[model samples]
Target chain A: MSNQEILNKLRDTIVTQDIKGCEAAAKEALEADISAFDAINGGLAVGMKIIGDKYELGELYLPHIMMSAKAMDGAMGILTPELEKDKTTESIGTAITFVQQGDIHEIGHRLVSIMLSVNGFNIVDLGVDVPDETIIDEIKKLNGSKVLLAGSALMTTSMQGQKDTMEAIEKEGLRDSVKIMFGGAPISQKWIEEIGADATAKNAADAARIVLKLMD
Target chain B: MTNRMTPPERMMAVMTGQKPDRVPVVPFVLGYASKVTGISLGDFYADGDKCFEAQFASMRLHGYEQTPMYGYASMGAFEFGGEIEYPYGKGQGAPFVKKHPVETIEDIEKLEVPDFKKELPGAYKQADRLASRCSELGLPVSVQVGSTFTAASVIANTSEFVSWLIMEPKAAHSLLDKVCNMFINAIDYFAEKYGAENMLPFDGGPSESNTMISADMFAEFAYPYMKRIHTHLKELGVNSVLMHPCSDQNKNIPHYIKLRNEIGWSGKYVWLFGPETPVKTQVEAFGDHDIVCGNINPSLFITEPYEELLEICGQNILEGMNSPSGFILAAGCEFPPNAAPIKLMAMLDAAEKYGRYE
Candidate 1:
């Protein structure tokens, strides 16, 4: 099959939430001797990007996104070993992401983490309710490598924690070492300025684009 | 004419589709009440007396048209044997489901309906006392109950609930049925004290927002349950319901208006933050029972310089007030606890300035 055909098949499997179809597509790409990089970039990444786009457009929901994410992750697993020989361990920029302390609702941040991973950024997901110290610890533990410290606040009540995290980074002497970004229902461009965040994202796709630009 | 009407009278006038002396400003004032009352939020919640005082103080401070039955945006899962982390003190964000009670289909199968009034003792006592207090003072009261979908999110935890919707949808429905029963039981308890038509808030889960879910998924998972509850309340004679589905509900706005009409919620019912639904669009689509609640950005309420913010907010007032649909000035979502008092005043101030009919 042509690469476009294989990519289209893979994307359909994800959008349709056909997990078995995703595995079969990965196997078909292998038989065609498609490079692992293209298989992932052109196949898995393309599928996830569509999922993200549809999600933003409100054409999709959590179940579809969740089911598709699982499918895409499975296909990536099948292709990663094949790419291991040619791909360097140092893939690209690193991002440290979490739900700021006291804000536990994190599906948005989780999607952003998944999208960032698919787009080849190293994601250090600290899960929900992460303290500034943990974020600082993750950055310093990276041994002077630049990283993106991303946080999200689902509640307006906890939005102050985003600013607190930023202040904590500055106090911990890692202010210049990392760029902070936030996203959620409560954040706006005005509030983003009030809080002093480096950037704000509407969704995972937007987050990926911004993270890529920040890295550049 | 504007200053002659008391807060409750002004609010009542609008609910019945009459011109109040002025536009009624009804921002959601829950945790923020504690801040103005000089009580810790935990005390306000944990102690019913303090909660009552805080609510009243919040009304006096904000010049809100209703007595505060204001409460945490929770589904009361903790009272129903779910693990919830109640925010214990000041600056603690709202409580949330700490651990989901249902992890498997078996867990869902074993669920039993808890006694609503007995389960949430503090909330009931507070609501009962607050209602009586408001009654004596001739004030209006507004309180919120989470919808079955939101309660299910709290009871099952959101991540697991989504999995159930996909994998074990039958169990998901069963759990939602159980939570709906809990809500009904609570409503039944409150309906006796508060009038049949006076329930203030019934939240449709934000997870069911069009931005968060597909129409198909919402139709299957959320719509039926919400319709069932709305129909249930209608049967009980409780008519006025505030359905706050936060964050950009433009995708589901038509369905919202349709659902309310279909279920015969003919009294004052609002779909707040069908966010960014144009005022003109809302009036045209909402038809006869059309009432525009709010679409103002809640984030704007926290920033500085009340005057400039009032100018921006004034546009929303002018448009909503000009619409044939009856209007109430409110934030798209809850008034942030940290939102400066002055900024909140600006919302009401704008309402009075630009919302005047005379």
Candidate 2:
């Protein structure tokens, strides 16, 4: 197949959420002399980009997003090793991310984690129900002089976990070294200020802009 | 004058575009009440009497005007042959998906509209028992039925639901049609049990905001099904429907207001929880034709100090105060189940102190 054909095939296969189809098409791309980077950027990435846009447009739904994300992951499983051989980009910085301790709703923060990593940032996704101490400990272990700490809490009650994490950052005397940001159903600029968070984000796209600006 | 209106009268006043005796205190508190009543999360969901008692105790204990219906996410969803896994172990958060019943698009075609008495016996009992108790006390019976999309989302999982919208639009409509049928039946049941006049027909779910879908998507999926429910009731002469969408669903506010217009909600009778929509935009869209509640950040109840909580509440009231239809002070969404007692008390108390109209 031609270069354009392989890329089109890759996009179509992933959109169907056929795992085997993705693997085969992705393999076919590599066999067709399409660079692994081109296969990902042109094919798999294009599928997810459409999914993300459609989701924002409300043309699509959350299940489609999960499926698209899954498809992207599946394609990467077959292509990452090949792309890694000639990769040359360095991560921008480390972002310490977690859903605040006791908050079960996690898709909000997990998406931000994926965006940051995809944008070439070293992402430490601490996962859900993570406590403050563990956050501080992760930042410490990173051995970085500066880091970004992100917390997400969907429940009004669990938002306290964001504040607690902030307090822990201060209690451990790491206040000056960290930038804390939060997002969730309940989070707002007013609440962010009241809780002493450095910033608040609406979604992964907004988060990337905020994180990049904060880094600068 | 606002402070002197009776609780029900005050609520009624706001619903009619009249000045309330004061700002109405209407917080959704089932989750909070369950923890306070010391019921295990599992037991709390499983038992109807306990659910009713918890809500009754919360009203008695907290003293808010709104009667929060203690409904679990799974209460109605599980009635359709799905498993529900509530957080039972130590420090577990909220209940979550163990398995989605509609694993394939074909499953959507196979399922039937759930019968409340047979399919959702426990939820039906809770509703029946609570409606009776509230009726005895002359309280308007309320049931917080999530939107059909939310019901369908749980039955099939959000991932499957969204993908179905893309890969299988036919199945998506089929599932939504089934869920909507169940809702229409449940609505008729409650309307008969309690007077439909007193019923709010709260069609709540994730679609209330753009966090789930764009306005066009909501217009395609949620608007049609939700409008059907409201229209069916309106044909029976019920004119109002209250929709609760969460987060900063500002983008969809105009669309929702438009949908509410179609749903036959008018004046202060139909209220939309204004999260991020500008006050001017709200007045511009519906004028004095609708009621607006909240945009208050719910997290303050959990994490903010009293003074900040009061400040945010005051700001929300002031913003909504300028609306032509009217404003009611409520958490932008449901109060955090673990919200501080003081904050919950302060919600009503702040209205008394700051939301008074001469």
Candidate 3:
């Protein structure tokens, strides 16, 4: 098969959410002498973009996105090591994602993290029920580098944790270097403005675009 | 002008599709009541008397039409012999499931519906006391039979439950059936105690929202169980039902309407929707047969200034007042516990100013 054809197979695996197929395609790309970077950017990332657009258009739902993300992760598992050997991996920017303290609903947070990762962002995933102090400590570790610190909450009670995390960032003098975004069922653009956060997105796909713009 | 109807009378008028003196304002106020009464939500959920007292006081303070009712989102876990944590800390909202009973497929086989009378949790005990108090005061006894799907989900981890709907349909069905049986048992208990004719059942649909699952998935997993529970409610001679479809459920409306029609459960469906579905859309869908209530964004209470809150509440009242069956202004979902009290008052004030009948 032609190298381009092999790359197309990689893309199809993600769009179709064929997890095993994605792993096989990654191997085929490796054998066909396709560069890992090209296999990712030219194939897997393109497929992710398709699924992301479909999700944004409401043609795809959570399970589809989740399966597609799993497919992408499988392909990345095969290609990441190869890319690392080349020492030429490039990322868009770093994003620190978490579900706010006292909330365990991480579906939205996981979706955003998956979208950002597939869009080439280095993700620091702080899992659910993360406190403000822990979030600030992660921000401190980012050390003045431009980062997108995103948090989500499923309940109104936990939603305040987002505000507290953002406030803690400001109190620790890390506000200027970081972009703060909040998303969840209860969050709104008006709430973001009220809480003095940087941005809010309608959904995970939109979150990727907003993070990209904020990074730029 | 002095009001011609008391809160109960106004609510009853709307429930029966008779013209009320004004539109009813029934905000889903739960923990917010505790916040108003200056009690720790931990204490509030633990003590039925306090929970009812706080809710009643908040109702009187706001002068809204609905009285205090006992129920929380994290319901099934505690009732099913799992653990739950109440909103005790600052900014803590409502009670949440601390542990799930049926964590695995094998656990589902071992699961038994607890005798609610024997294994009553804090909330259930409190609900019992609340109902007793209502009965003592000659008020209608209110009980919860909501989102059998949500209760089932709480019994397991939510994500696991959603995944089971797709991956393990049999297990999902088994769990849902068990939950329905549990609900039926609870309904029987409540009905036998309070007399079904004098009871009102509160239902909420948070897990079934389109944002969480596809409408097709909802139809498959949530619909049948909801039908079963409502059918039981109907069988028990319960006439009035208040259902809150808590979030964006435009896609799920047809299924809900179908359930209502199939079961022939009509009248005051406080079918309050979340802000994701507009009031106009809800009225257009449910206005003819059910008392359409709510669509006011709950976030507005915390984020928006008083003027904005008033304007939003007023807009919803305008859209909902002319509902053929009836209309009751309400927050889209549970009123935020941390929201400014004045914002809730804005809803009542809006109902009075803009919701009056000619």
Candidate with better DockQ, 2 vs 3: 3
TM-score, structure 1 vs. true = 0.90
Flag the better candidate by lDDT, 1 or 2: 1
Best by DockQ: 1
Report the lDDT tens digits of candidate 2 across residue range A1-216.
689998998888766666678888888998988888788778876766555556555566555566666777777888889978966745568888888766656667767776665555667888977876788889788755458887887765567666677788888888777788898767789888887878988776577668888877
- lDDT of each residue in B1-358, candidate 3, tens digit only: 4758889889878877789998888888988898778998788887888988898898888888878788887788887778888777645677777789989988889888767677564467788888888888777788778688889988997766766775689999998888888888888888999899888888886888777778898888888888888888888888888888878888999898788789877545668888888888888888888888867877778778888788888888888799888888888888888888888888888887888896
Name the 10 consecutive residues with the lowest summed lDDT in model 3 chain B.
Answer: B114-123
Better of 1 and 3 by lDDT: 3
lDDT of 2 by residue, B280-340 (tens): 5665666557776755656667667888777777777776666777776776666777677
Instruction: Give the DockQ of candidate 2.
Output: 0.36
Q: How would you class the docking of model 1?
A: medium
Give TM per candidate. 0.90, 0.81, 0.94
Off by over 4 Å in 3: A27-40, A73-86, B1-3
Candidate numbers, best TM-score first, in rank order: 3, 1, 2
